[model samples]
Target: MKALFIGGTGIISSAITRQLSETDGCELYLLNRGNRNESLPANVKVLQADINDESQVAKLIEDLSFDVVADFIAFRPEQLERDYRLFHGKTKQFIFISSASAYQKPLSDYRVTESTPLANPYWEYSRNKIACEEYLIKQYREQGFPITIVRPSHTYDERSIPLGVHGSKGSWQVARRMLANKPVIIHGDGTSLWTMTHNRDFAKGFIGLMGNIHAIGEAVQITSDETVTWNQIYAAIADALGVKLQAVHVSSEFLAACSKEDYTGGLIGDKANSVVFDNAKLKRLVPDFVASTRFDQGVKQTVAHVLAHPECQTEDPEFDIWCDKVIDALQGAIASVKGR
Candidate 1:
């Protein structure tokens, strides 16, 4: 089977490309921005095209017909609409990489399934994904578009620096700070539960769906069954790095108040809490789909990777600015309380 991967150069997509290349009887093709071709297999055909350009994408798809198209980075509605039209009647299967963020969460609720209502107020990200899923399903019903949607939780590879658990800047920042012997910053009392998945396992689940007729017209949650609190996750990382998990936990109430002030550009509270996903549907489809890397194991791998590659250890500027604003608001709040 000829499998074409769009956005195949990403961390998760790289894993998927490797898996496809290793699988016998399957040939892999990659269509990416062509920025990072080093990790890709030499035998795999590479097509350089800007995904945002419809003409470029359409021209490429017309020439190289694929049995399956795994889109790793279709975030916006325009991107999805264009890609859907380009591959509408041509491809056998259209696999979309969606996110658990598509569903609104009160982590305490736990066990959210594919059918759960998506409560995304800031739909810029989640709404667009949900919209694309809806569009694909519509196509499946009317035009028989073989669409399979996979919603993965916080997927981490050795290279991943996920922001949900490690703060807005991601775990990479924490790893860098730990390397510098600085205290790790914890947002919102360090009590939120995080559901993280290994990128390898996530890639395998994506591959497992290939050409499987049962997976078509269905959405599956690809994630680890276990849930870990933020404090525990940080402690595990600290243990791995042989550093004390000395973190300054910020109060959610303070953050909410800070998000309101102009100086801090308003506070952003944890709208989602203690949330977990039910991947029973996916497990039933791919019975042997088990996450091999535990949270601690994944953390260790990520830390080791960061330690090995100093170049990969850069801070996210946006997150740093946001953190600075929050800290400013926090100091202001402390002063106000003292004055009162």
Candidate 2:
């Protein structure tokens, strides 16, 4: 099978790229601007063109076609439009990496499946993803576009630890605080259920859908069955870092009001709410798919990788200061209430 991945070097797609590159009789091509070409496997071919530049990409891949083309970076419907223009009838299968967050916000039910209504008013990112899914589904229905929608929920890799609440830079600041014994903020009492899947595990199920005729025109969510609370997630990170969890619980609304970043979207729209994915559809489609990495094991590996690689530990002093400020204000509020 021949597969082409657009923007392949990312947290989720990177694992898929690695999986396909190693599979027997599989030919893989990565279409990107050649930024992290060195990180890819040796067998994977490189198409050195920006996916946004339609003409340049068209010229580059004029004579080539693939069994699969997966786009990881396309966030908006316009991007999907560009993909349709570029790869219409060019590939056997087109996989859109949609987010599970595109599922209904403040869901009527805690369990999320592909059938979950697409609605997220708080985050434009999720709304755009929802739109992209709708467009691709329409294309599949109207034009016989061989499209497969795979929604991933909070998938993590070795590069970064997954967390519900964190600053713009990344989750490194929170991990740093854990190591320093400083209080880290967890939104909403830290008991909300969240599922975190390792990218490697996500790769297994995604690969199953590559040339799968059954998967075309279907939307499937692939996530781990393991559900852990936000508290357990932070505790795992702190355990991995060999530090005690000094966590300060704060309201999601307060955190949104305090931060300059789009916490309203990142938190309320997506991570703040409890989500437990029903991977029954994914299992039915990919009979062999299983998410083997537990949260503790995955996060432990992630924390160790970040500790070993100083480059990954890029400190965010501004976020750190902001965390301290939030913690201090919360403490002051407690003091004032006690005085009253």
What TM-score does each of the candidates earn? Answer: 0.87, 0.99
Q: How accurate is candidate 2 locally (lDDT)?
A: 0.92
Clashes of each: 7, 0
Model 2, range 1-340, lDDT digits (tens) per residue? 9999998999999999998888999999999998888878899899998899999999988999999999999999999999999999899999999999898998999988888898999999999999999999899989999999989999999999888877778889888888788999999999999999999999999999999999989999989999999999989988999999998999999999989989999999998889989999999989999999999999889988998998887788999999889999999999999995
Per-residue lDDT for 307-339 in model 1, tens only?
788766767656545556666666687899999
Q: Show model 2 residue runs off by greater than 4 Å.
A: none
TM-score of 1: 0.87
- What lDDT, from 0 to 1, does candidate 1 have? 0.73
The local distance difference test score of each candidate is 0.73, 0.92
